[model samples]
Target: MTEPNTESTTALDHVHRARLYKLASLAFDRPDEELEEALVSGTFADQLLESAAALENDDLEEHARAVVEASPTDAAGVDELYSDWSSLFGFETGGDIRQYQIEYSPGTLVTSGDTLADIAGFYRAFGLSIAEGNRERADHLCIELEFLSHLALQTAYLENEGDETGVAVVTDAQGDFLEDHLGRWIGSFRETVAEEVDVEFYRALGALVDTLVGDDTDRFGAEPKTFEETPPSPLEGLNDGEGDFRCGTCGPTSSGSTPEMPMGDRDGPY
Candidate 1:
């Protein structure tokens, strides 16, 4: 007789999908404070962490759906939030959302065309699965989705009691997504949003993304790349055609000139 498979199979359900979809929507919809509060205090937060701790995928689809539905509505009160989001994530920006919808959104994934409505429809159709492509941009979306998926899975495991296999799978998926994709470009994306946009929601969301990326890296024993940490140049020191780093102490210091060293007789004394 053939051996029966003993491993449990857990597919994502409506509640779970809703939860993740709502979280993403909220990330784009509300202000940072509101989003933060929801993530910490709401059922979304509870279920995510719980599932990660336990590693269950039951009802994960439902959680993802909840995230989608709750997202756009939660931020309805703040028009500015959507405006900034549109600027940052819309089709014109050449950002991930545009690329994501192009590559993974159900019917649109394989077909070719560009339009705002088309992209929005794609999001509506595929919801969170829009991030599943193997391309670079798709990889980023995958990372974001994996993060949410891990939280959902963790919540499921916790609620149903500890399940090692489920937790391992969730953690493995999260680690793979991060180490392979989102971790690679999210920092640049966050910097772009922080530098180019004025919206508090995006800024806060960027910070949250940074935090989550860091946390995931630490969790998976991945070493992050160190970008140049140049401090913001003083605005007052800037002049016509001058770059921010031009030395202010020495007026109009030539960009190519090396400053003269102090006339200490160290060569003779030392």
Candidate 2:
């Protein structure tokens, strides 16, 4: 029900895009002491709530407020929550909270070639690049969300310049990106996060993600492409012993050669 108000030509839209970017960035980046402090101190919550209010998204405002309200009050509590963050996102205790779109999307492998390349191309077209030290791929959920924020900010700029063509382009890009990438997997991903983490703050975030994706999908009439019916992987059929199997993705695998490597274990398009 909540939609972006693009009628304004002021700083309001910029502020909204910034808040969305911050929220998305937090989803991927490791939670640190500073982040905990920000949550407990109410500064981050205020900014989030203000942005949500400006956008007239009451659900988002409530969710943002709830995260701050549920934040740990003491230092030890914050540390515990930080540990929860690690256990849920980091590989601290074999974390199951996957932050990549490919991992969540049906029929998508960790090393999906064209999908990753296309996403990276979009980033480069916008003058964005993954940080050198960043461990995640360009299609990582956090990166994708940040890209959405970038698109929104860019849309505002185009609007300011009265460049109708540019505004339409940016708008179309947002819809396409969401439908093709995030929208397809976000619902399942949100459910996974909520199921994995017991922290109320994180659960609230999961709810927010679910709602945002659902809202946008409906708003744009985005019929996301589902690859659920995609054929089995070559590796899956290799053990059948029916006949010779040559993997087009990797190389030859005719009994004596090394087993075909996993898709993600090799170098990415980036």
Candidate 3:
């Protein structure tokens, strides 16, 4: 059996965590017919409950139940869901909610090409590339969450094959990635989501992803520096010409929505 450590979580745990992360990514994606069908039919919620239950964490299970109970039952409810999604996560300029990682950083981490390159490096190292159709940046929330999900799934695969070294490498990467990226700002993201979002379903979602990532952050003993603000550049006029970081790499990645498991992918190991 593969041992669970901070550097790497257990195989079974990784499986559940992967599903949880993927589900959160799918939820945040552009609301579509496939997603609506899953939500309306209750399969999304059911799979959520199963994954949360599989993890055997009371808090995750509780929040997962909240998500399940908060599902939309009809088209109108789905429309409302879409409205909230656009209001908080749409393409509108100067939107209240910011999903990109660079938005929360204090220093040049905002527009720093190095940070973006490092993020893309993580993906490339694992044979995971951005989907050709995914217009979102490497630092976008959904992309980052899906990246973690891919890493977690990979960890499980390595562990099942008794590749202890592989497990350690992947787990260590997860820890470092969180400490440097997601864990640092997701708390702030969650706070923003809670404070700005009106709908119960999204609020529940914010809480769920926050809690799941929090648990893993604890497991890795990573204390990421959280940000408080979520808007326009502090260096707006001071550095006018600099553009946001872009890795310019988009290749075979995963992204699709199904009824039962919701294995929506924007990146997968190639």
Q: TM-scores, in order shown?
A: 0.43, 0.74, 0.79
Model 1: how far residue 111 lies from native, Å: 17
Please rank every candidate by TM-score, starting with the best. 3, 2, 1
Task: List runs of model 1 lying over 4 Å from the truth.
Answer: 1-25, 29-77, 92-143, 150-160, 224-270
Candidate 2: lDDT over CA atoms? 0.69
Candidate topping lDDT? 3
Candidate order by lDDT, highest to lowest? 3, 2, 1
Write candidate 3's Cα lDDT for 129-240 as tens digits.
Answer: 9989877789888899999999989988998899989977888788888888899888888887888877788888889999998888777666677865646656555653
Could you tell me how far off, in angstroms, the CA of residue 98 lies in candidate 1 after the best superposition?
Answer: 7.1
Per-prediction count of colliding residue pairs? 50, 0, 4
Off by over 4 Å in 3: 1-9, 92-94, 108-110, 228-270
Model 1: ten consecutive residues of lowest lDDT: 1-10
- Candidate 2 Cα misplacement greater than 4 A, ranges: 1-11, 73-75, 108-111, 218-221, 225-270
lDDT agreement with native, every candidate: 0.45, 0.69, 0.81
lDDT winner between 2 and 3, please give it: 3
TM-score of 1: 0.43
